[model samples]
Target chain A: MIHQISVFLENRSGQLAEITHLLAENGIDIRAISIAETSDYGLARMIVNDAPKASAVLLEAGVILSMTPVCAVEVPDAPGGLAAFLQLLAEAEVDVEYMYSLFTHRAGRAYMVVRVSDETALTAHDIKLVGMDELGLK
Target chain B: MANYYQPEIETASYEQIRAWQNERLVKQVQHVWDNVPYYRQKMEEKGVTPADIQGVDDLHKLPFLCKDDLREAYPYGLMGKPLADCVRIQSTSGTTGRRVVAFYTQHDIDLWEDCCARAIVAAGGTKEDVVHVSYGYGLFTGGPGLNGGSHKVGCLTLPMSSGNTDRQLQFMTDLGSTILCCTPSYAAYLAETIHERGLKDQIKLKAGIFGAEAWSEDMRHDIEDSLGIKAYDIYGLTETSGPGVAFECEEQTGMHINEDHFIAEIIDPDTGEVLPEGSKGELVFTAITKEAFPLLRYRTRDICVLTRKKCSCGRTHIKMSKPMGRSDDMLIIRGVNVFPSQIETVLLQQGYTANYQIIVDRVNNSDTFEVMVEMNPDMFSDSLAKIADAEKELVGALKSMLGIAAKVKLVAPKSITRSEGKAVRVIDKRKI
Candidate 1:
């Protein structure tokens, strides 16, 4: 399970930069990021290198945010490899709530962090779930 | 039981009420002509005189006094008597523009209080009952008018003077106030606080005389159910005498105008033509009894209908339906009067444009006031923290200016609709 930090941002100018600047100043690197937005406000979700450190600085800066458990998987970097893994989940009728790509260290391979409607159903799939530590980085 | 302060006038016959108005209108016209030069000059310009206003039938012959006229008069030009003769003055919020100060002689005060006393009595008040007046004192007439009336009724008067909800509830519980006097929003607030504090059963209130702002029948029911009291409506303006020019009797159908002191008329707002009875139009009042500031045919700008419907309460005075709306762009939120121009003034003063929209809605039976302002291009690029800080600053400025807290939201530039003609600046979602 990877700790995904979701930050609530008012749909205004430089909101993303504010969050990124605060994280950068604290020396916390964001490994993966995705944004879901509405006309008035938006939510920026990120899987950072250090969850506790990212949470502390974001909270200190008065950024409204929360942390959730997400399953990270290392899929083949090739398009057919990614398609084959999704087909297995589709065959099992496992609903993927949301999935975002991450920067992986190993060549010819990619990281996909996903939040599924039911994580317990993932045990039936043949794909292995990767841990936050497995994504090696300095 | 029927309780009327002055039974003779309150239960007067139709003919007697008409005779009183006719006689008083004639006398008041003569008085205004001789004492108020401003009004006299207006009448002369209209080719009319005191002789022309012989009775209530001739009320139309007189000139109309609107808010602009009050502004034109300013501090004292329209005052009918010598400044020394006036015992006191009460003023409007003046949020719209210039403040309107109404001069009142001691005689005027006595009559105005008597009118309020009539309201108190109609709301089941007595010497045994305690009257808690939470209307703001000083320049606002809501407090002093009801306070004087409470004194006149010989009830144990509590001049609470608005705000400090804890103190209001403390005294209300300890003193056993039977009659509550204030704006309906404050009444609703007090009711909500009492229920939340679980002191509902401890309250001994029997009735409330609420006015000085518009309230709906549904709100009246809400207040009644929450406070466990019969909520009554009172109608008046600082231009007249304040919250007792007319009052709701037990019938609760409409407010009865004190015919002896005032003659009520409905006129087409645009045409200035008098509308017949039961016709909805702008409400106009001719003050027949006020001495220090007698205004003949003063336009109230309140839209309502006048009905001679026989009330079960037995008051012969003509009843006026609750004001449906206003002819101008004035709004009442949380019982505090607000004008769009007041918001515009604050915005422009804060270096924002006049292009803003005021959204007023009733949520959980309380007014929710929000002002959505359009950010300039420069402001639109500011950091989120800076934008939020700007909103907070505006909230403070508006609260200080209007004496009420308002939520401020900064929106994208030109997001709010703009009109070439008279811009629609307010959107009130309250069903009532």
Candidate 2:
């Protein structure tokens, strides 16, 4: 259950390159990005490669976005793979309100994408959860 | 059934309007001690003269007059009647600091258009109706005091001055306008452009008066349900002779004050004393029939309450009420007249950081405003399109220092809200 997106900008400067140039001119690929800001607007949040065609090219370029369902796991690209998956969501009490990471060209892998305030800890992490047609690189 | 352009002085008798405000405060304190020597040197330095004002209970022994004594009596030191007995001059939108002006006399524009024809016969108007007005003509006594009170209530007037909300609804639906006179935020911007042009059944309004600014009874029931009429509330002041000096009958509870040509009085705005009648202070006014600006115990930094109750539309003078706040920090927005030190003198003349706030709310029923400001660690490291072109050059230097339009937000660099004593610079949220 991965599908992210989120937007809503206006803390100005080329609004994250105007939403990554309308998702790289509609060939979408971002795979993991975060922003959050505040003091007058900013959200951003990505993990694209076409979350429904970057939410219809950022809603026909007027842009202010949304689309959630997150959890993407996969860790071990070495060093205790995200401290043993955050010590198995702190021994399954599970509550990671936010998390981010990327780096996948295989070789010992890496992903991390969480956003969990407990939605059944998305099936208590049987570990490998990176769906969207298995992120086989665009 | 309440149309009184002057039913024996709008239903007189509180002992016949205190015997016509004790015979016009004894002939306007012998006409400001025989023609204003700066209110006879503030009544000879409050030693009290005009034979110690012999009526309206010696109007608290005269001498108040504020706004820095009309900016130290600028042009013609409060002219009681010279300049060949004045015929006009209105002024004051000097937002705040110079530019009061005033004068009038043609019997002070026939008693300021008979107190704006008793607020268009207490907003039910006649002369087979059609008024219109739209306040803001020349030196601004709200469009020649309701265009000479819709030509002394013989209606059919128009003189549409304010802005052009689509040719003021094309002469308010091709001249069938049955009274509307402006400034309750331009009648909530002509009732939001007649419900956004669906032209509320081709308009034929049946009453509205409003006033230069400050409006709320939930924006008078949202401009009386988007202009289906009955919106009243008129009160005046271009130093006592502008909108109409108090109106609202049909008993929408308060206003009434023409107290036989102005007398009002609440006081104690920091020790000027006199508060008694239902407390809550600072409104003042004396003008007892202004013959070319006759302000006597003036000091109206407005904040109100005056009652005398008893009225289910019977109008026996003294009502006041709707001013409720402002012994100075000005504000009013949408109906123009703002003041946070005129947005901190256009943010310290455009260099910024006097840290800001403003806010003011009420959306669809008009007036929103905003402001916010703060960004100053070298404008918080600039470059967010140069902080949105410095919030569009501080919304064009606060719409040229408060003639209106605001929404300039910039926040984050100390994020607004610092105080140790009195810096809560306006929030408003219009519940009035």
Q: What is the C-alpha lDDT profile of model 2 across B1-432, one tens digit per residue?
A: 767887888787899889888888898889878888888887788798877667887788777888877887787888888788787788777654656888887888898898888878877787888888878788878888888888887888988888878988998898788778887877877887788778999998977888777777877887888787888888787888788888787768778888888888898899898988888898898888888788888887889889887887887888888887788877777666777877888887778778788889877767798988765534432123445676678798778666677887765434456688545777888776
For this target, which candidate reaches the highest TM-score against the unseen true structure?
1
Candidate number with greatest DockQ: 2
lDDT of 1 by residue, B209-256 (tens): 999887888999999998889999999998988889999999899999
The docking category that best describes candidate 1 is: incorrect
Off by over 4 Å in 1: A1-138, B418-423
lDDT against true structure, model 2: 0.78
DockQ agreement of candidate 2 with the native complex: 0.06
Per prediction, the TM-score for chain B is: 0.96, 0.37
TM-score of 1: 0.77
